[model samples]
Target: MLDPLAALRTPDDPPCDVYLTGSVFLDIIFTGLDSAPVRGTESWARGMGSSPGGVANMATALARLGLRTSLAAAFGDDKYGEYCWESLEHGEGIDLSLSRTVPGWHSPVTVSMAYEGERTMVTHGHEAPPEESAPCDPPLARACVAALRPGEGQGWIAAAARRGSRVFADVGWDETGRWDPGDLADLEHCEAFLPNAEEAMRYTRTDCPRAAARRLAEKVPLAVVTMGSEGACAVDGGSGENAEVPAVAVEALDPTGAGDVFVAGFVTGTLAGWPLADRLAFGCLTAALSVQEFGGSLSAPGWAEVAAWWQHVRSFDDQGRAALRRYAFLDALLPGPARPWPLRRAVPTIGFRRV
Candidate 1:
């Protein structure tokens, strides 16, 4: 991948641009399902792809975009874990110095069925044993991405924040059935809080997602709410900046990791100091490109995809001036002598190992 931030490199820069830690899952995606499987019936899919998922999804997305990304997670000592480890560390050029392989542990697996632009997933596996998970000592980086659950904050988040690492957080569903904002104490240390529209509304107790964004902004410096196909909105409490951008239209194959991809894009733009709207648009563009492919991490679009998409859009006569202007930042950021390929997507399945 071309280095988008090459111009900003300094002798004293951090060793990594993004540091991530979470569970890694082996994702097997089945697309083109005509319908949801009926009870007692076998459903066949037209396509299948495999890749690393969970935290690995965000890590891959960030690395593919030329971010120096480090991942800290537990990998099972199994073929599945080997495949995921190899894909992220070797194929995607992510740093796994903080990650470990757990003996006798089963790699978590998620079987995703894509149908009608949505997916149904069945996942199996146990959490990594505490002793086998990532260590408490986090690496210093420009920023870190953390998933805030509906409970006490992860101690590492506060630690990283105090260490001058910008923290960006994504929220999952409130399984406890209590959408208590106080439960997310970690947001205090986060530079941004990203939640889906439904999750935002529930957490903020607001019927409207936009209002929820405003409410969340009070808790975090930046509050972003993704509204699926409609697009996303962000409120920057610090600068009083708010921006919304429409989703780029594309036929989605699988959305398993699209949210992760979007967050990666947004973080990339934010670190680059792009305007608020550009950040949201870049994030949305990356996500739109992601779904057009298959799988999760492997389906992430690198610079190859971004340059190709930009060139293709520029060649067209009808692409609006506004659309071009909105993403004009890419014109200056794309590395010199760049060439576009159809894409740099990984194979439909994890490629076979050579002897």
Candidate 2:
């Protein structure tokens, strides 16, 4: 297993760089598949793994990037809850002091099937605790990562913003087809609002990603729309400047948590005071590296992997060099060529032999 935390900052650090608030889930991932299973056919996966999911994926990604990360979420008293809590606190070095585990409640779970560079997931969860009755104290970190919901999210976001926290807000796909822009009222208190291409377009009533991003930018300080293979585009609401970054080329294994990783990368770049283009480039790079592996939180690439990739890319000829110049911010993060962590599971699970 790779020890990404070996170079982490001291535990006594005052406040973390990012604070995340969302549901914590146990993800059981099945990998090494060429295609989806047919009806009534029993398909066997070559590999199986499990790890923390949901906002935990973002926390792990941020921590892997050397950011002091903290998470505040309710958990269950079950063994799976303990497993996730311990993994986040000890394994990833995330500060979970503000998180709590409720009695009798079970942690949410997601079963993900990975095939052909994509994932099909089925999630199971109990009714969440009321948002008004938070389990623990809220964190006041440099940035806050959260999902926007109607009755929830905005309260803490407004509170965090009042105290100068940069709120990085994201939204999930709305199956309800009620992609009402008013649902995003929380953006008024957010520093940046990021949504996938489909979500953005639907929310903005636009047919194009660029138009969606530009429209959303009018409501928030920054708006970003992520298009899987097409890359990402962003609009700065204040200066009206817009930028686009192409997706990094990679053989994606599982697309699960790529969006969360992208947000983590963008937050990391933003906290480092990088320019808009560099921030988007770094975000795209971080996410591309993630889909090359398996599992959600476990698949995030550490600084070592990033540094190593930069070193390899720099040796490319003129054509490749021009294409890679967008990732120039990497030089500032890594001064020299560095070794890449061996591609292996950060959190591995025992598997059963096929019959």
Candidate 3:
């Protein structure tokens, strides 16, 4: 079979392979704790990190996978904004040609506290006055990751789909108790819709994850519901083929961006035309590796890490390797044994300050 990725090759340097758009924020993360914070108690964290957050998480993950990713979002003219813009564009190699900076506005900020495998986040930002029109003009790419809001992004998602772009849409948790499926009308424009188990259940008014996945599959071409620890399930609306992959087991340090990293892996596999089971397996591994580190965007593993893990799994003795046989598909995706893919250190989480 011809490689789907080969058709996407570009003569120009760094052609956009994936286009992403959504809110951008600087994230301050606090890790290392035995339990949740007690009010009025001064607690010290073992480690602290700060990096560009929100959509930056997905952008960084995609870029680390060697995809030419572009982000279209608004930034502030403030120092924090400049720092985030530089980190994502220069450090992560994400294309920022479509982004904008608004003078007098301050960049959004999120403070995340990771304790006992999960995290709690608090965000702060002022809503800028609405522009006469929407801020983004959709860019053409082989695939697009759409950050959805009720009544927003519908047009752009449709336009991207009309142009044959694969749209993978993710929605935020609805604060209102009403998780109406009517709000998901935009799913018609998306090639795939990825929602966590809770969100999927709420949206579908289903009692369980599998039921939610089935209901979602009824709407979109593909439906994936992420069940933390339990792994994820996907159903193809066209063929009615459904599959689930178990989560890769690992000692998690922080689970901040695991979901986004999973999506990035799935997106990479989808773009490469990998089999559905392989795509889900790859996503699970990507997320498993991500939680072994701290911070959001900076924690994502690169292709080098994937290659290293593949080698490590194969080198295990028969008894040790028995558990990882499920991931044998990784062997085909990895570099040849003679070709060494060196693992590079992850980008440090740098505080945003204009210097």
Candidate 4:
């Protein structure tokens, strides 16, 4: 891990830099499909991979960015759960002290099909029994990633924020077709709210995404609106800072969890005290890099990936000086000639026969 906040760490500081809570899912992704599976006909994918998904996407993304990530979630006793636990705790170095194992419930499973840079996912599983049996209180951390939803109580975010954690909130699609901002009462406790262009427009009732972000800024200290290929824009209500960055051009494979990676990258830059535009660009770059790979959690770019991409693109001299200039901040953050340890793409299965 690169430890982007190493300079700011102290013995008195919270042990974790980022904290999050949500359901972890075992994801099986199928790629290289010419089209969606035909009805009454079988379709075979040319590529497939298995890894942890759901909130694990954001956790893995944060950990890969060198943040001290602590996750509070419930895991199943199934073999798939075992694989997901091993991947996050041991493989990615995430802290799972606040997590627990449900004995009877099986892990949630999501099968995702990737076609034309987008994905369709079908998920199955039963909810684990209530956490009241063994309540796992959240740990103190510098920041928290709160996945907001309508009609869901997020009292823990308020508690964490009171304890000095900067809360960054994002929401899943409002399935009820009611994007009622009033339902999100916890926005008062958050430092920022990140929503895609569509969601932002719906919530703020604005014609343009930037206008939506501006309106959202009135609700939270920071408002971020992500536009698929156009890029992302942010408004900092406190500092009156406005930043917008264009998306990095790259061939996208599986776009699952790309949003999580972008949030992770943005959080890293924010905690590191980078300029607003630089933070926006870094988030765009990390998310773009993630879509080039297979799975969401495993595909998160580490410092090595950042270092390598910087060196390669700079030497190529093709991105144009204006385009590359925004990323000049990376030169100061990367170590001298650091190479990535190894690629960690997901495979077809967790188990393989020994040679």
Q: How much is the lDDT of residue 114 in candidate 2?
A: 91
- How well is each residue in 161-230 modelled by candidate 1, as lDDT tens digits? 9989999999887878999988989998999999999999998899998999999999999999999999
| Candidate closest to the true structure, highest lDDT | 4
Candidate 4 lDDT, tens digit per residue, 168-278? Answer: 999889999888989788899999998899999998889999999999999999999999899999999988889899998889999989999999999999898888888
RMSD of each: 1.9, 4.2, 3.5, 1.5
lDDT (10s digit) by residue, model 3, range 128-236: 5555677444777889998778544467888888877889998888877678888888888899998999999999888899889999999999999899899999999
TM-score of 3: 0.90
lDDT of each: 0.88, 0.82, 0.82, 0.89
Top-TM-score structure, candidate number = 4
Per-residue lDDT value at 342 in model 1: 52
**lDDT per residue as tens, model 2, 180-219:** 7877778888989999999899988899999999999989
- Candidate 2 has a TM-score of 0.89
Question: Per-candidate TM vs. native?
Answer: 0.95, 0.89, 0.90, 0.96
- Steric collisions counted per model: 0, 0, 0, 0
Q: Model 2 segments beyond 4 Å from truth?
A: 1-14, 128-137, 150-153, 317-319, 336-355
Clash count, predicted structure 1:
0
Shift of residue 106 alpha carbon in model 3, Å: 0.9
Tell me model 1's lDDT, rounded to 2 decimals: 0.88
